[model samples]
Target: MAPSRWDRLPGGRLLGGLLALGLLAGCGHDAVRRAPPRSASTRAWPTVAPADPASANAVLMRALGLVGTPYRYGGNTPEGGFDCSGLVNYVYRDMLDLRLPRSSRDLAAMQGPRIPEDRLATADLVFFGSAGAVSHVGIYVGEGRFVHAPSTGGTVRLDRLDGPYWRDHYSGAKRVLH
Candidate 1:
């Protein structure tokens, strides 16, 4: 007669060994982490430049100065408020005479250079999202910094491209240089 079932462990030897293998595989599933770029210059670059200056980046710098401003969905003026793309259009229009689309969707469709974070230039449009959609945009001033209107109850301010929140959501960046 066959040995009584209770005489053996609950799991068959083969099953137990497979379970151990699975556990080991689980421990090795961690994804690789990518690091941000570092600058060779000791002096950190400024986030934005003056509205008008001798530097070619003056326009981009001026755009960054609008960060921290509240997100107004539809507001379009400095005193009132601004939406994501609206603020973007306004800045380029005012600073560089460049007219941009009024909505994030439309702006995302524009053709531009897909620049890496390390090569980001002042005035370039930094996009955010998984599909490289222009869900959110800001002006890259320099030194891994950007200027944008954060949200309601806020004003324009500067932010780091590598910030916890921004880094996670960053999709891509673009530059429309003539």
Candidate 2:
């Protein structure tokens, strides 16, 4: 049979097919492993809708602006750098005048509507941990991504929620911006 339209392209059918496959392969995986897996008996907590979209947007903007700030364990200001919860606290406080708990564990325990992953909204706090204990936290900026001060020597940066380490340590999320 004569060459088809695909063959008429610059790279031809084989190269085009390879490119398409490469793009599809970059889309990532199906089963993301969330640590401290939820049991069937786990409570189906209520999701909180963002009552103030403008405030949420402002919080997101502030968090994004702090992307390159260095990590400091007890830091809470742009000039002083920040830790995970410190980053969350600073962004919320600076943008919305909202005061949140100063540590990741305390922030996790603070009263707020629990948010299912699918229902996560901008400015929601995503938690991570293992063995049923909350450890790290980040401000969700939508699209399965968050901005956080990841570690010592690491500057605040954006990370994928479904990225290997984050996904495996993913504990839960809560909405503090209602």
Candidate 3:
């Protein structure tokens, strides 16, 4: 007889509970543990020149400040709230006069430096889902967390890249700023 799904797990209920709390390994499947980048500086956040709108710090701060904004599919402004891609578009356009591709898939496909997950830094655009078929994008805020307008009924918020759900779905990352 074949083993049940639960039976295949080493600790069954204990492991299930730990996964639920993001304590144990991610999803108990193909989860890869990618650590966030660290800086030599003692600052809580990574240092970058904020004077330049193209600077990573500038972009990251702008995105972080918009947390709690309502998620609006197809919406693009703070007044109207924002969707994931809209938030990215608005930030780049408003901060640097740089207009990014409108959809998450398009943004993921845009020409830029592809960054490895372990090397992700502030303001990098992190993608989720398969390559060429990415479904979500977020602004990396260092320490393995990112800010994004996740879904309908959800507000813009920060989430861990190493967390179970995201760890399993992580596709790749890109450096939007040259």
Best candidate according to lDDT: 2
Residue by residue across 1-178, what tens digits does model 1's lDDT show? 6744443777566676777788777656532233335543343544444233343365665565665566777877777778667777887777667788777667667876667666666767777766545577777677887777766677667778778788788887767554
Worst 10 residues of 2 by lDDT: 39-48
Which candidate gets the maximum TM-score versus the true structure? 2
Positional deviation of 112 in candidate 3, in angstroms?
Answer: 1.9
In order of listing, the candidates' clash counts read 12, 0, 0
lDDT of each residue in 95-164, candidate 3, tens digit only: 7788889999999888877887667777889999854479999998887789999999999999988777
Which portions of model 2 miss their true places by more than 4 Å?
1-49
lDDT computed for candidate 2: 0.86
- Angstrom error of the Cα, residue 30, model 3: value is 33
CA lDDT, every model vs. true structure = 0.68, 0.86, 0.81
How high is each candidate's TM-score?
0.63, 0.72, 0.69
Q: With candidate 3 superimposed using the best TM-score fit, by how many Å does residue 34's alpha carbon deviate from the native? A: 26
Cα lDDT tens digits for candidate 2, 12-67? 89987887788776654323433457643343433445678899889889999999
